[model samples]
Target chain A: MEKTWNNKAWFMVLPVLVLVAFSAVIPLMTVVNYSVQDTFGNNEFFWAGTDWFLDVLESDRFWDALTRNLIFSAIILAIEIPLGIVIALNMPKKGIGVPICLVLMALPLLIPWNVVGTIWQVFGRVDIGLLGRTLATLGINYNYVQNPLDAWVTLIIMDVWHWTSLVVLLCYAGLVSIPDAYYQAAKIDGASRWSVFRYIQLPKMKRVLLIAFLLRFMDSFMIYTEPFVVTGGGPGNSTTFLSIDLVKMAIGQFDLGPAAALSIIYFLIILLLSWIFYTVMTTSDAQG
Target chain B: MDFSWMAWTLPTALFFLAIALMLVGMGVWEYVSPGGNPRVGVLRFETTRGDRLFVSLLGSAFIHLAWLGLVGANLWWALALSAIYAIGVFRYV
Candidate 1:
């Protein structure tokens, strides 16, 4: 049967489109304006053409920050996806345990971004914080402010704690939606636990997993608040991801042109990556 | 790193106002629907998932506020709160 596509749904989406344009589009255009023009203190702009973009692209600092962003995102995806699935699998399928797991998973997500950073900041302080104090007593020289390795580890740990639950929630939703009949059939066919997960649950969870991956990737890539609060893009710029660098340029140095160009480039990269992910997931859905 | 004074003001004022408003709103709602259970009313306020989610959210927010007051925004506090809230939901709801 041919389904009639409802045009009325567009109205429902119109509000969101307007909100997004206000929040995303105008700021983007402003950035585009800044990227191509040099401005003095009096709000005057002169044509700089692609000078800022070229400067940004050719800089070693930009490359380093980009590399850090890519590596951080890669690490987060690798760790969170499997860990989240395992957590979802172990959660109680029914009865008392269901809400327990869910609320625990949700708590980190609910805390404000700045608060998470502050919490980690204090928690990692060697003098007053628990983790740092314990590590110090054990004779580990573990100051994140001084050591690049410590800074990286602390940042990674903070992100994992903050975001792993999102993945878990998505995977759990996918898991719970599966029909009991599928499991029953697997049992009847004498399918092993691994086989059940591999052939049925994993495939069933593809869409949600894709969503989890995309959300996590985008969020990790754009992460600024927590790390900024914790490290301030210091320890000799070791933990300075692209977002942090952009903020430093725009706010710290007030270099409007290059910062604007960098932001546009950053937005484009995220958009491209997201499109690729959508295409891959949808095409796989068609095949499956 | 020195603790900025701004964090002190923003979170406290915002948290208190939010909680006060919620409680006042609930009080008014209960006064209008005198026969309805307040706890259940609080729980089932939202239609999509019912009052359970509402109650859970309230409880979690309270816990978070209390943590901020006591521990002053430490990472462990966030981690602990997350664990507490997640457990509370599974067990209570």
Candidate 2:
């Protein structure tokens, strides 16, 4: 069948394009403007060509935050991806329980980022917080505000609790989309549960899993609000991902030039990593 | 100190009027395009459950504001309430 191309479809996309340009592109341009210029308190900008960028590149703080972000993203991907798949596998494929299970899994992803932090903050409190009080009662001495390890653990747990559902949902979508004929063929061939998952389910889930990985990686690398809300990036900067550090530099210290440069660099890193992820996943899909 | 009734009554009435405006706007939209919701596109992208979830999030933002006004910025309570609202939306909406 020959397909007719309709140019008017572009008009349909115009509203979203306008919205995105305003919300995303304009802010980005402003950031770029700030990055390339020096600003004083009176909202006056002076041209400072490459000076702030050079300073940011040379700064140890930027490097440390970048490393922390990379490590956190890696840790989250490692934990959540496998755990999500396992949870999805365990969930009932068909029954009255399916919607119930799905709803329960989706509960965490609904909470706002700051609120996720707050929930963990109170939950980890030694007084009225459940986890903290229980730990203290058992002589575990857990305090996120005072201890770096505790803060890191609390942040990771909070993120996993909140985001693992996303992974599960993606994986579930993949699993459910597989044809019944494929399962029937696998069953007729006397395939085991492990074999069925590996040969049939995993392959079907590859695309959504790639998407899940990318989304999780990008979000985890840019994690700010939850950690900021929970620990305020304290306990000796243990939970200070790049986003938190950027906000701290820009909003807290009001170092516009350096912060702008850092922000651009951070944005570029995310863009680059996402591009790389997309390339690798697509290439693998083509090969497979 | 005797509080003035007009101060409370006027603000409350105006607040409700603003809410009524949003409801009327939604009703007009539903009336105009009954088959396809005008705001469906905004809801469909980003998340799977679509625009209903987004609408629920919008509603919860109002709830959060009300909580802040009434309960002195209890973050955990607000968070929990919002989460419950989202969950309710997932099932019912």
Candidate 3:
């Protein structure tokens, strides 16, 4: 059958275009407008060129927050990807157990991010929280409120508890899509368990793994609400990722120009890094 | 028509206009010459004309940003560097 190019087909896409314009483009334009201007608090503004971008780029505070964000994202990807794969591998393939496992895995991801943070905030309290009191009873000086390391540990664990389920579900979906024929063939070949996984399972899961990696990376990189609620970027700016810093600059201090510039820079960094990750992963996937 | 609430400035508006123009131009170019003829280059991944354009634009942004960060606020040299980078991307990438 031959395909016809109809101009009316564009009408189908018009709704999405309008929605995107309203949701993304308008807000982004407002940010861009603020980025290169100085405001004197009377709704009066003046052109400032790239001065704010320069200031944000030069500021140690901005750099420190960016560094923390990158490190946090790296640690998350490191922990979640493998942990999700392991959990997915262990998940029962069929019967009543499958639905139960899936529902259990999905429960954490269904919770709101702020709610997850709030849960951890109370759950890590030394006086009342289970984990904190247990550690305290074991002679561990665990105080997320007072110690930076403890704060980081709590945040990372909370994030893992919250988001690892997403990876598990994606990987499990990928794993379940594999047919019985492949396994039968592997068994006939008398392949070792590791060999079967390396050759059959890993290759099958590559696409979902890539999706999981990108989603996790982007989400972890822009993480704000969870850490903000849990730590409030406190213990003296220890957990202040880029979003938290941008908020503090924009709303907290009312430095609209610099904050807007920082937002642009932050968005660009994520775009650039995600593109790089996509390119690299897909390239490797094509080759191997 | 009342963009006063947005606090739009001349330079910023012009900047957005230029970007919109580029996107329109790209659309026109694609309509005229479809397929884009993806090819592998220095990056070792297949990319079409639009991909190269995106890469160049993204690179140019970073170059300008780095210039602002490392050197002074004068952006003439940064613009020059970005133009060269765009040409290189179109040619090679």
Best by TM-score: 3
- In model 3, which runs have C-alpha deviations exceeding 4 angstroms? none
Instruction: For residue A167, give model 2's deviation from the true position in Å.
Output: 0.6
What DockQ, on C-alphas, does every prediction get? 0.01, 0.01, 0.81
- Please, what are the lDDT tens digits per residue for candidate 1 over residues A146-236? 9999999999999999999999999999999999999999999999999999999899889999999999999999999999999999799
Which 10-residue window of candidate 2 chain A scores lowest in summed lDDT?
A41-50
Shift in Å, residue A274, candidate 3: 0.3
Candidate 2: tens digits of C-alpha lDDT, residues B1-93: 643311223333464466567557656665676643322232232223434544465657556545654564454787688789877765555
Ten residues in sequence with the least summed lDDT for candidate 3 chain A: A40-49
Q: Regarding lDDT, does 1 or 3 come out ahead?
A: 3
Model 2 C-alpha lDDT per residue in residues A177-235, reported as the tens digit of each score: 99999999998999999999998999999999999999999989888899999988788
Candidate 1 deviant stretches above 4 angstroms: A1-13, B1-93
Chain B TM-score, one value per candidate, order as shown: 0.38, 0.46, 0.93
Error of 1 at A226 (Å): 0.7
TM-score of chain A of each: 0.95, 0.96, 0.98
Q: Model 3: per-residue lDDT, tens digit, A117-218?
A: 989999999999988999999999999999999999999999999999999999999999999999999999999999989999999999999999999999
